[model samples]
Target: MGSRVMPQGAQDISDPFIERHLVIDTSKVNRNAERGGFTNREQNGVTDQVSSPRRSEIVNRSLSAVKSFGNDDIDLEGGDVEKDRDKTIRGSRIVKVRNQAVLSGLAYCISSCSMILINKFVLSSYNFNAGISLMLYQNLVSVIIVSILSLSGVISTEPLTWRLIRVWLPVNFIFVGMLITSMFSLKYINVAMVTVLKNVTNVITALGEMYLFKKHHENRVWAALFLMIVSAISGGITDLSFHAVGYSWQIINCFLTASYSLTLRRVMDTAKQVTKSGNLNEFSMVLLNNTLSLPLGVLLIFVFNEVDYLSTTPLLRMPMFWLVITASGFLGLAISFTSMWFLHETGATTYSLVGSLNKIPLSVAGILLFNVPTSLQNFASILFGLLAGVFFAKAKMREKSQS
Candidate 1:
């Protein structure tokens, strides 16, 4: 009844499908061998009594048996092919991630070094005494750019509520202090010594971590910190153009920098609670910091009497001056963006490592580009300080991995 009701061609099509999968099993073959139906003659010591046609027939059956085993192997080979394809896909993704990390790190290094050099040119070379105004203008540029990007949906940022602003106010104040002191120090100090002196920030941060967060450090970390101190002192002693005011400002900058880091870490969670998304991204932080700084910066301009200087300075009349300062502003934004990008793509470990290594080229470029006075001893001390930073980063990485 089933055959009678089937379609005209259904039986023929179904026959091959069933036959392909219903090949002879190994157990059936073994049973046949025990029954002496198709056994190997040599294994049983049987004589060649069969005719030549019969022998040819046995050989054909043996070939069919081997082909059956090959069928199973084909399925396994198909699985291996699938695995290889997956591996290829994963390898391509990793390459793409690595490329992104490299690009971000390079952008960070270029923007960072360029920002410092440009600031030095405007402050020292151009003899511009208005550091606060410069900081204000650069930050204004950042605020404008970030606002545009956020509105255009090119990046995501948390909405800034008053609560969030209040939560971040303390950190922003320290941020202002850090930036102002850094600018004052850079105005009088050569770039190389400034870079070396900045190493003290790490020591301060480590101590802050120990005292504030109740964290402990490995002995290797302490050793690296001590080395950093030695290098800073040695560098200062050998500096050919040492300025007491510069050194004092730098010491304050270090403390403020450390304070900014510690305070930001503590306040971040509280700030997030006030945000619409309950998450504050790097862009939001950049926008918030720059926006909040504007009013404070204005007040500072009045206190420092920079408005009169800005009004009278002939450098403002030159289109070239505007171009340079504007470029520095863009580079300032680039530094912020690329630093976050590098950290996101490669994690903090690689970011810290690259940052440590970046000081070397910056030091050399600062001396050569500005022709800052330097002796062999000062250069050695700078190198030592830079190496100490690298050693510190390595120690922290090892300690993190072990923990």
Candidate 2:
């Protein structure tokens, strides 16, 4: 077809394509222009296209074909935009996960350190003699808080049926013994020394795992364990205010702690068997242990002759003492929840690593806060033990990854 040129400033309405082939829908376009979706420059371009057509219909048809084929598929800028959008989404998700893990780790460290300090204060500072009673009170607080949470639907917990209780009873006894001995040891031993001595539990647990679960460890793990033993012995020998009773209690506590760990692993399988869902969660285990400990704790209190001590102790009369003890109880519950959360958010290896490294700051805090008497030799031993713990965790992690 031949084309004709129009006069300057004259509007061309030759084709009238929309009016002839399709119904016109200018209302929505006009509304959009009024709403700013179509800017003044865009509106002027439309007016120019109607008044003075610069390109032919053949060029317009080619542009329409390019648009229909998808500009993003062929254009490098569009591809780059898509990649940037995807990167932004993935980066946001990574940031969220990292934030959660860091928060959970901090919570675990604070609650664990605070719980130990509170117990030490009550036992040594306040001169409280009733270890079993203290444990009982803490467990009672846990039960009360957990029950309230369960009732309010803030958390879920498995029901404490008779079968579940029976399965958990053995582990509960070991758990009680562990807590009582730990409390007793903290009465005389300084927190730093106590933390160093706790490395023994890891060694015992490793040995127990080998024998009972048929698990084997790498040479580095054994080497780390040996370093732990050496550090503990050196720390003890150099301790200026070493108490025979405290060391004895801590040795017993270590064995009990190892037993509790090994026993709990077996008990978990049995516990799950009793549940209808065949799943046992961390909160359920927390509730079970604390709930079952109450009766055993009460029995132990009488057996330990702490009832008379509690009756005569004037510290109980102090509101500040009561407040500190109550806070310890809450911190105990917090430890359980935070530890579980941290382990879930990260992994077992990261949890152990953080736990081992946590003792460094905790030991320093303990020494500074309580004015604990210590020699340079003993302090060196403490640092050695802390490093050994970190090495042990890394060794275990490496061993796990290899297997």
Largest lDDT belongs to which candidate?
1
The root-mean-square deviation over C-alpha atoms between each candidate and the true structure, in angstroms, is: 20.7, 21.9
User: Which stretches of candidate 1 lie above 4 Å from their native place?
Assistant: 1-95
Clashing pairs for predicted structure model 1, backbone only: none
- Please give the distance, in angstroms, between residue 189's alpha carbon in candidate 2 and its true position after superposition: 0.5
The sequence of per-residue lDDT tens digits that candidate 2 reaches over residues 1-403 is 0001111011001110000001111111111111112112111122324333546565555555665475443333344664566667667777877898899989877877777788888888888888888888877888888889999999998898999888878877787787788888889999899888888877888888899999998999999999999999999999988999999998998888777666766776778899977876656767777778888888888888989988998988899988988898888777666765665576555666777788889899889989988899999999999899888878877886788
- lDDT, candidate 1, equals 0.73
The number of the candidate with the highest TM-score is 2
Model 1: how far residue 54 lies from native, Å: 15
Candidate-wise lDDT, in order: 0.73, 0.72
